[model samples]
Target: MDNVISVILGGGRGTRLYPLTKERSKPAVPLAGKYRIIDIPISNCLNSYLNKIYVLTQFNSASLHRHITRAYKFDNFSKGFIEILAANQTIESMDWYQGTADAVRQNLRFFNQPNIDLVLILSGDQLYRMNYQEIIKEHIRTGAEVTVSAIPAERTQAEHLGILKVDEQGRIIDFSEKPKDEKIIDAFSVSPSVFDRHGIKAGDRTLLASMGIYIFNLDVLNTILKETRKSDFGKEIIPDIIKKRRVCAYFFDGYWEDIGTIKSFYEANLKLGSPSPSFDLYDEKAPIYTNPLFLPGSLINSCKISHSIISDGCFINDAEIQNCVIGIRSIIGKNTRIQNSIIMGADYYESASHIRANRFKKIPNIGIGDNSCIEGAIIDKNVHIGENVTIKNANNIEQLDAENYMIRDHIVIVPKGSVIPSNTAI
Candidate 1:
């Protein structure tokens, strides 16, 4: 682990998660109540005792940079540090990151340093906790040129993921990216023995799907990038390199979700309030780390909150919250009913005089106002929901672009710093 360097890919534009990604990168998007999506992988790396990490981002990286800089600060004596490598127009290449492999290629100078044996590549937007030391251990034991963390996927999930066929020795022989045809997908399936070895049911028709978590021998990574012109790993590089290199599959059976879309983003946040969440953030032994805001406990006054997670410094007064995740510094006014939603709370709290001034000027201060009904929505930071506003989207719109908000998958997304006037209906 000491000889390994971790690179988290956060350079995607994240168009699928539009309004959320409108102001920040995908990795910077808020998760649960207080944590960001990048926090998951970074925390996992820290828990594995791998501290030298580089987060690569090209689009809307300001907030991500601030959060990382504030949250992770190593002691002066230690060499451990988390650095941000934003896309730059160097003389060698003036283009932005073309793809995953190209992004690594452009930043080769930083990673091609001393005493680095393995380069562990991970996605920043995934929601899962993995002990990367296990993958590195297997990579060392097997003497593999490249090792990919894979998971057992059913047919429904296999179509969208990178499916691979492995032999008895756990070496990947063939790979396909998002094959829609059933016959082609079946051909890329692994044997039942593979599932049995991973403790999965033998009768299940599951194929080994790449989780996009890879460990590359430093020398091998340098060689592949120098020889090939492929842009992406899953789409082009891995499929071509499996024939020339010893590419092994590391099976991982755990909770993993790629919340890159609006629907998935919404569901993943809402699922956190469930009785038993798939991803556990409350694990004390391997807890997720984030920016420590020293705010007071949430104050609830005559509110009925059920199966919800309310973060710090919330002022809830006579509100009914159900199956929601209320973020830090949230303020819910009286007679508000919110369900199946995620309120990303405020970045900063307004003073008493500021609130009075805003009220006098007829400006909605922050958070939900009184007599509001919000369901199936994602209210980003600094949103001011006015009184008597109905944001139910009763039409069940699959998609729409309203003046105040956007609707995707029947979920209204109020982008950051939006203001909805009073008595508005949607």
Candidate 2:
């Protein structure tokens, strides 16, 4: 609705995804090689015919902000755009947003429309695709003050999520934020017939965990924020209002992944190449959009590729690749092999004599000698491996330089734009 506004919570330290997020915010982390994480929600909004978006974040948001500006350029003359609402300490009582509620509270000034009916709040780092219109329909039908989109989770996983107890009418009767052991012991496994595939269980004690998506009537949202007087929906806001307010649950079931961890992120990327992935970005219904690179079609140069989502303008020559995502304009040397890894993560390309994996630990020295062999690693942009360099786990250091790179949990991270010395070991 033109009278509605969307707020995306993008603020988080994202310390868990250290090296990847070192120079960028979580939302800014590149997804699908070309699109950033924030594009998922923005694309959802655009496809669902929702406009007016505000992204909230604090740490290293420069890249995220730049991408948002460059990617989201709808018809400004009408009423479609994506905006980043960063943390600002304009008020004497102001500080950085401490929690979710606090983040939205800090940007209340953006909600200036008297006609605005609902505020759609979402998380920026999740990997999924959905139509928000359906959730909005449920929200209006229930006449709820706050409607949360929830999905079924494993009982053990539910312990770490903000769970909901919804009545037959789909109205949330109880809400608990990341409940403890005994509190969720009696959790029910809702019957398949209890609710449709949205993973909604309209059963007794069948706790549904919130997916961090909320739809609130603007007035009710303003009122709740006023009443709570504290930041964060889980810690202060929602938990405090459920007793005195009508907060409902909207169940959603399709596919979603919060790729906030390096392992999860890597796993999610590999899943994209699976025979049947949990999340599919190529869906025509809700296609994900990002800043257009306008690159040409990707070309595989007689290379053997088992399973990889190679984007535009890629060249492969007698190389072996499996379970990897190759971005645009990336080149693989003849006879080089890549397996179970992400490569050329950024959109860059330049003709190099030889480049291969397993050099992530070593300096990214190009000019690899003819007989060099490499494997099992991540390669940063524009690295040159000298000719005849061998990189493998069997080598004596099993780890490499700290000045240009560092190994975290066995994942080699090459700092951006560092050249590896030839025959580097130890």
Best candidate according to lDDT: 1
Enumerate clash totals for all models, in the order shown: 0, 15
Where's the lowest-lDDT run of ten residues in candidate 1? 197-206
Report the poorest 10 consecutive residues by lDDT, candidate 2.
363-372
Clashes of 1: 0
Output the lDDT of residue 141, model 2. Answer: 84
| 33-86: candidate 1 lDDT, tens digit per residue | 999999999999999999999999999999999999999999999989999999
Instruction: List per-prediction Cα lDDT, in the order shown.
Output: 0.91, 0.72
Q: Could you give the C-alpha RMSD of every candidate to the true structure, in order shown?
A: 1.2, 4.5
- Please report how far candidate 2 places residue 363 from its true position, in Å: 7.8
